[model samples]
Structure formats: structure tokens, C-alpha cells
Target: MVQYTPRWVGKQEESIHIAHIASVKIDTNLLLSNVLIETTGGANPIRCHGHHKADAVRMKALIERYQNDYYRGGGAPVGSAESTPAGR
Candidate 1:
């Protein structure tokens, strides 16, 4: 599971389990790099910014690895496809 604390005023932290995460997207530009974590729990993806591009990439990889491990361990919902991709 990944625990993320959003940089928002008066906002509480949130926890995202590996089995529930749908995707991890990394967006980078000349100035900043951000990671968007999409989950099956909601419509809004978790946005994490202010990290180096390499760090964001590493985070994405780690999340995908956990997700893959979850599915391989038979944690995916019944009747769902077993060979689903790690990220969308």
C-alpha cells in the first residue's frame, strides 16, 4: 500500500492499496515533474508533484510492481482478466 499526503490546505492524507490502483502516470516538463496515481476507488487521480523526474519514474515503477504482485497473488476480483497490464 502507498500512503500519500497531498499538498493541500486542510486536506487529510490518503492511502492507496496496490490492488486498487489502476495506473501511475508521470508528467514532466522543463520546470517540474508530477505523478498522477489513478485508482479504481474514485474519479480523481492522486496528484503528487515537486519531485525530480527520476524519482517520479521510480515511484511509478514501484507502484506498478506492487500492483502486479497483487494480481499475481490472486488478489484481483473474480471473473476479471488475469493477464492485465501493470499500468493503463
Candidate 2:
């Protein structure tokens, strides 16, 4: 199951975030680490020598890592379009 938060933006209701946790396989022998992992979206399946079930703590850490990368990684600037004018 995934965890999500809801917030109110003006008069509209919105979801703040959605966090998901699942078991992932890591094949050290694989040339591409990402291929060794699996996600929900439509992606190419990869070989899995073994899998490790992630616990709550590990899931939390992974969520944090994902958030950090999405928000602060070496890519487009965060809040690029969310900023609002002082009077608006």
C-alpha cells in the first residue's frame, strides 16, 4: 500500500504526496543498476538474482532519497513554476 497526504489549496482539495514501498532486486553483476530494479510504470523487465523486502525504515529512507533527487538533484530548478507573486 502507498501513503499519501491531502492538503487544501484555496477552495480545492489536493494531494500533497504519495509514497510507495515495494520489494526490489539488486543484481551486483548487472551492468545497469537501474535495470535490476523494478517500478510500476511500463518498463523493460530485468533479471533478478535475488530480492530484498524493504522495511518501514528503509522505505522511509528511500522516500527521502527520491524526494531529494526530485527536488534538489542536478536537474531543473525546484519550484520553478510553483512560486506565486507577493500580491497574488
Candidate 3:
């Protein structure tokens, strides 16, 4: 899960699993970037801001890589909750 937790209380944390992520949009200025991650469901998108350009690019790349690896059944380690066993 990609979690974004706030420092202050009374605000709920945002978490979007790799499988649930539908799309990733990035807006960049000269110094900072904003990454908006929308989910497959109708839930609100995860909007993260104020990141370096390289960091923003790298974040998108990593998410896509993980998504591909997950679907290929090689990303999740064996005997972990994220990975299901064979034969139900």
C-alpha cells in the first residue's frame, strides 16, 4: 500500500494498493511536482505534491514496475499476505 499519513490528527490517511491504482498523473513546475494517483473504484484520487522532478518521475516508474511485477506473479514474496498460494 502507498500510504500518505498526515502529521496532524483528525485527518484520515490515504492508501492506494498497486492493483487498485488506475492511473497516475503528474504536473511539474521548474522545482516541484504533483502526482495524482487515481484508483479503479470511484474513490477519490491520491494527490501528492511538492516533490522534486526526479523524485516524481522515479515514483511513477517504480509504481508501474511494481504493478507489472505483481501481475506477473513474481513481485510478491512467497508465504506473504500479498501473495496467494496455488490451488486455492
Candidate 4:
């Protein structure tokens, strides 16, 4: 989740599961960056603003890696598979 404290009334937070994420976009200036994370549920996109360019790039990379792993592994639990179908 990305959180921002706005004037102390309450904090605002945004989160999306890797499988629910529709897209991740990044916009960069000379030094700063912004990220937009869109979800398949059609809710408000998560807006991440004013980060370093390198950090934004890293965030995008991590998200992509997670998404890839989730899809490639069929959302399996960590180390749950053991016996082969033909054997068991």
C-alpha cells in the first residue's frame, strides 16, 4: 500500500493485488517521477508522486516481477507442489 498523510485527519492509502493490477505507468522529469497504477476493478488509480526517477523505475520493476511470478506460478502457495501428477 502507498500511504500519504494529509493534514492528520486520516491517512490516504492505495493498494492493488498483483493479479488485479491492470497496468503500471511512470512519468519522469529530470529528477522526479510519478507512477500510476491502474486496476481491473475500475476503481480510482493509485497515484504515486514525487519520487526519485531511479526509485520509480525500481518500483515498476518490482511490480512487474511480482506480476510475472504470480501468473507464471499459477498463484500457488510457496513450495506447495511436491509430488508429480503421474506419481501421486
Candidate 5:
């Protein structure tokens, strides 16, 4: 015996697809903190063997590139917590 399933005639048309883009909040303190933690020479981790100033400059550049990409790709607002609001 075969079970019959109702065919969907473009049923997904009514559904809304909301995209979530993770935005990076660039803070010097936080960047440096992460670099330090990762670079500590105890175990194998993402290590940065450079001066703080240099590392900061590099990270800042990276952050700017990411922000540009986000803006270009029509990313969601800079600080929206929920995936989607009830109404829209």
C-alpha cells in the first residue's frame, strides 16, 4: 500500500526568508585580549607573534573589510538581536 501526500502548489511562496548576518563590533581591547589569549605559548592555538600595535592595525583592517562586505551584501541592521519580529 502506498500513502498519498498532498501536492504543494508553490506553498513556500507565502513563507518569508529572513537572513541573519553576524556583525563584528570592533573594539581594540577585545581584539588585543583575544590575541593575547590565543598567542600564549602553552599549547597549540591560533598564535600571533607580533607587537600589539601591529596586530591591532591588522585586525582593524580586517574589521573594515568585513564591515564593507556586510554593507555591500545588504546585511541586517548592525544590532538586531532577534532572528525576525512577529509582524515582519
Candidate 6:
């Protein structure tokens, strides 16, 4: 899970599950780095900022790994063949 706290008032905190994430993008300027997380639900993408460029890169890599694993069935699904009594 990823939790984001807004930089200003009147904005509620947001939490996103890795499984629900569709993509991770990074944008960097001279002083700040932003990580944009797009979700399958089509809501506003979660924007995480104030990170270093290297940190943003790492975050993108991690999210991509999770997304890849999620799509490729790297983790066993509930009642999947790997979880069946005979297949176990």
C-alpha cells in the first residue's frame, strides 16, 4: 500500500494498493521529483513529490515490478491451480 499526504490543507490523505496501480511515471525538475501513479479505477492519479531523482526512479521500478508481477500471475490467485489440494 502507498499512502500520500497532501502538501496543503483541505486535502484528504490518499492510499492506494499496489494491485490496483496501472502505471508509475516520474517527472523531475531542478529541485523536486514527482512520481505519478495511475490506477485502473480511472480516478485522479496519485502524485507523489519532494523526492530525489534517484528515489523517484527506484519508486517507479518498484511499482513496475509489482504491476508486472500482478499481471503475470507471479503471485498465486485465490483457488488457483497452485492453491488446489492436488496441485499443491
Candidate No. with top TM-score: 3
Residue 29 lDDT, candidate 4, scale 0-100: 81
Determine which window of 10 residues in candidate 4 has minimal summed lDDT.
Answer: 76-85
How well does candidate 5 match the true structure, expressed as C-alpha RMSD?
18.3
Q: Put down candidate 1 lDDT per residue, 1-86, tens digits, no spaces.
A: 54546465755667766777888899997977999989897789888878899899999887776667667766763334653564
- C-alpha TM-score for every candidate: 0.69, 0.25, 0.74, 0.73, 0.28, 0.67
- Write down the lDDT that model 1 would get: 0.75
Q: Rate the local accuracy (lDDT) of all candidates.
A: 0.75, 0.38, 0.79, 0.75, 0.37, 0.77
Candidate numbers, best TM-score first, in rank order: 3, 4, 1, 6, 5, 2
Q: What is the lDDT of residue 81 in candidate 6?
A: 76
Off by over 4 Å in 2: 4-54, 74-88
Candidate 3 lDDT for residue 11: 57
Q: In angstroms, what RMSD does candidate 2 have relative to the true structure?
A: 14.3
lDDT of 3: 0.79
Q: Is candidate 2 or candidate 3 better by TM-score?
A: 3
Give the Å shift of residue 30 in candidate 3: 2.8
Can you tell me which runs of candidate 6 are displaced by over 4 Å?
6-13, 74-88
Q: Tell me the tens digit of each residue's lDDT in model 5 across 1-86.
A: 01122356532212111222123222345335233222123344332333365665665465455456556656543344422464
**Compared with the true structure, what per-residue lDDT tens digits does model 6 show for residues 5-79?**
656665566777768888888899998899888999999988887899999999888777666665677664444
TM-score of 3: 0.74
lDDT tens per residue, model 3, 1-88: 5565566765566666788889888999888999988899968878889999889899999888778878787667334466765523
Higher TM-score: candidate 2 or 5? 5
Kindly list the per-residue Cα lDDT of model 2 for residues 1-88, writing each as its tens digit: 2323334653433222322222344443333232133345535433333323333335445645665655664432244343334323
